[model samples]
Target: MNGILETILVIVGIIWVIVFLLALFLSPKLSATKSKNGGKK
Candidate 1:
């Protein structure tokens, strides 16, 4: 039971890292797009 829990935790941690990286990578692009629109709104 303990081993299973550890494996699940590791998998979740990996997924979290991936999502964090994606957010970090895309945030600048999104900001750039907004800026490019010249904030006319």
Candidate 2:
């Protein structure tokens, strides 16, 4: 049970990191699009 919990935690942590990275990478483009469109994004 403990090992399963640890594995789940690691998987969740990895997914969180990936989501953060994706947001970081797309943020600039999103902001630019919003700015160009007058904050419509």
Most lDDT-accurate candidate: 2
Output the lDDT of residue 8, model 2. 100
- Kindly list the per-residue Cα lDDT of model 2 for residues 1-25, writing each as its tens digit: 9999999999999999999999999
Report lDDT (CA) for all predictions: 0.92, 0.96
TM-score, candidate number 1:
0.72
Q: C-alpha displacement of 32 in model 2, angstroms? A: 0.5
Query: What's the CA error at residue 16 for candidate 1, in Å?
Result: 0.8
Q: After superposition, how far is residue 4 of candidate 1 from its true place, in Å?
A: 0.7
Clashing pairs in 2: none
lDDT of 1: 0.92
Candidate 1, run of 10 with poorest lDDT: 32-41
Question: Distance (Å) between predicted and true CA of 13, model 2?
Answer: 0.3
lDDT of 1 by residue, 1-41 (tens): 99999999999999999999999999888888988999443
